[model samples]
Target: MSIDITLTVNGREINTEVSPETTLVQLLREHLLLTGTHVGCDTSQCGACTVHLDGRAVKSCTVLAVQADGSEVTTIEGIAVAGGLHPMQAAFHQCHGLQCGFCTAGMIMSAIDLVTREDDLDEATIRKGLAGNICRCTGYHNIVKAVQMAAGQMEGRGHE
Candidate 1:
């Protein structure tokens, strides 16, 4: 049987039907066509499916679609504005944090959540925060730098 769910996604309220076993990643990527949230691994170890579930970073692959019923969900595609990118996404691009770009979306989403929750961010904190995300392209240095840069930008805006 299909379960009816109502959730706000990327600032849009959605009413959809999903099976009990349907995952958030599957709902976003397959059903909603929000392909930016990736699925890099079968295990939930990879943060490639990271997204903001009610403003907190979570691996979408690990979350059941029904579990997020009535919750707010934000994917990588949701963070940017019309003309400019989100600060974290811009930092990732500016710092060359991505190589193949497969993992960039999740990285930026995770970074935004990390920076949003933590203040006075540094290299160590950024690295520790990003422990869940794994980039096989050997781009950790740039990723850390991007997080740091985005943190600084977010801090300048004075919104914790």
Candidate 2:
């Protein structure tokens, strides 16, 4: 049976009919045509399918589409606003945080949420905050730097 549900995605409202078993990752990538969320592992150990559900970072692969009814979702595509890259995205690029780039989308998303609403940000905090995300390339050094830089930038902007 197809289940109908409404989800606010990337600031756009979307209503979709999906199977009860349809995963949020599939819903975003297949149904909505938002392919930025990648599925690296089916076991949910890999954080390649991370996204924001109702402003909280979650692994979309572990969530069902039906579970997102009436919820707000933020994918990587939504982060860039007005043709400008988000601070996290820019930081990642500036810090050379990615190589294969397969895990970049999820890593960036997780980092953004980790730094959001945070007052204290340091290398340890950023590293621990990214504990959920696993990256094979760049060895997490640049990724951590990117998160720290993004955190500083976000903190500075919080005052403006």
Candidate 3:
């Protein structure tokens, strides 16, 4: 049987009915048609399905649609604004943070949450913060640089 679930996604309220076992990644990609949140591993180790739930980065594969009811969810599609890309997005582009692009969105989302919670963003902190995410293409060198650049940009914008 389907269960009713309501959530605020990308600043918009969404109401739908899904099975109790439906994962947030399934809902975002299959039901809602927001496919930016990728699912690389079902075991929650890849971090490719990360999204912001109530201002915290979470693995959408590990979260059920029903569990996100009434919470605010932000996928990669909602990260930018009317003017241009979010700082992290721009930094990823500028710093060549992504290779193959499979893990870019989750990496950015996790780094965004990390910087939002801290004032000092250094290489070590950025590495530690992004430890949960894995990227095979870049070897994480460029990814780390991208996060550092984005942290500076976000700090300048007063996002934290």
Candidate 4:
């Protein structure tokens, strides 16, 4: 049986029917065609499917489509502002925080959540905050730098 769900994604309201077993990641990539939220692993061990649900970062793979109903979801595509890159996105680009570019979206999403929630961010704090998101490339050194850089730019902007 298919259930109808309504949720706001990437600042757009979406209404659709999905099987009860449909995951949020599948709904995004398959139904909504928001391919930026990658499904690296179905088991949620990999944070590649990370996105913001109600302003909090979550693994989209672990969340069911039905669970996201009535919630606001933000993908990497939504983070950009008016044809410009978000501070975190810009920092990632400037810091060379990605290679192969597979995990960059999730990493940036998670980093945005990290910067918005934390205060007085330091290297260790940033590392701990991003522990859930994994990056096989760039060794996380540059990733940390990107977060640090974006933290400054994002300050007082209240990016969410």
List where candidate 2 sits over 4 angstroms from the true fold.
155-160
Q: What shift in Å separates residue 120 of candidate 4 from its native position after superposition?
A: 1.5
Error of model 3, residue 92, in angstroms: 0.5
Q: TM-scores of all models?
A: 0.95, 0.94, 0.95, 0.95
List, residue by residue over 3-107, the lDDT tens digit for candidate 1. Answer: 999999999999999999999999999999999899999489879999999988999999999999999999998988789998888888899989998888888
Per-residue error for 15 in candidate 4, Å, reads 0.8
TM-score of 4: 0.95
Query: Candidate 2's residue-wise lDDT over 79-142, tens digit each?
Result: 9858789999999999999989999999998998888845677788888888888887746999
lDDT of 3 by residue, 135-156 (tens): 9675699999988888877853
User: Model 3: residues >4 Å from true position, as ranges?
Assistant: 155-160
Please count the clashing residue pairs in each candidate, in the order shown.
0, 0, 0, 0
Alpha-carbon local distance difference test for all models: 0.89, 0.89, 0.91, 0.91
Worst 10 residues of 4 by lDDT: 151-160
